[model samples]
Target: MDELEFMRGRVYGADHDDAAPRPGRVYAELVGGPLDGLLLDVTDRTERELRGGVVLPTEIGRHGPGGGAVYAPRGPGDRRFDWRGDVP
Candidate 1:
């Protein structure tokens, strides 16, 4: 499997044996920062949610549990989210 396929299993869990995206489930690749290369499951998120971005907790982040990694979609048509930075 390729890097993304490997990450899909790692991020979504081992039970997800299939590399192909599941129907109705939206996924975006995280670019840069602590969560780089990880897939964010935005399946149930709305367009506003995607545009406003999200804060995800990560052990590798600068502030650990006190802060989170900020990620926002590059654009409406982009499938990758760029890391804005860490938030406290």
Candidate 2:
């Protein structure tokens, strides 16, 4: 399956553990890049000891100028994705 489906079916699935990343309603802010202003599905997050980062798995979103929708993976330390609110 695709990244989005895999993430949805596995990572955020009901069968997943409580520590697993829960899906959030709001889109995360993509910091300092062409991806700025573009929204992505807030999949999961890493803990503060893990450097406190947000996870953006494969999801349908605008890529950039002249670029159409695409499935992208923005993990911790990417410097491209950022979340300012409370983390779960």
Candidate lDDT scores, in order, read 0.75, 0.36
TM-score of each: 0.73, 0.25
RMSD of each: 3.8, 12.3
Error of 2 at 37 (Å): 0.9
- Model 2: how far is 7 from its true place, Å? 23
lDDT of 1 by residue, 15-78 (tens): 4565455667778888988778777777778887789888987767888777889998999858
**Candidate 1 similarity to native, TM-score:** 0.73
Give the Å shift of residue 88 in candidate 1.
2.3
Top candidate by TM-score: 1
Find the candidate with the highest lDDT and give its number: 1
Model 2 is weakest, by summed lDDT over 10 consecutive residues, at 64-73
User: How many clashes in candidate 2?
Assistant: 0
lDDT (Cα) of model 2: 0.36
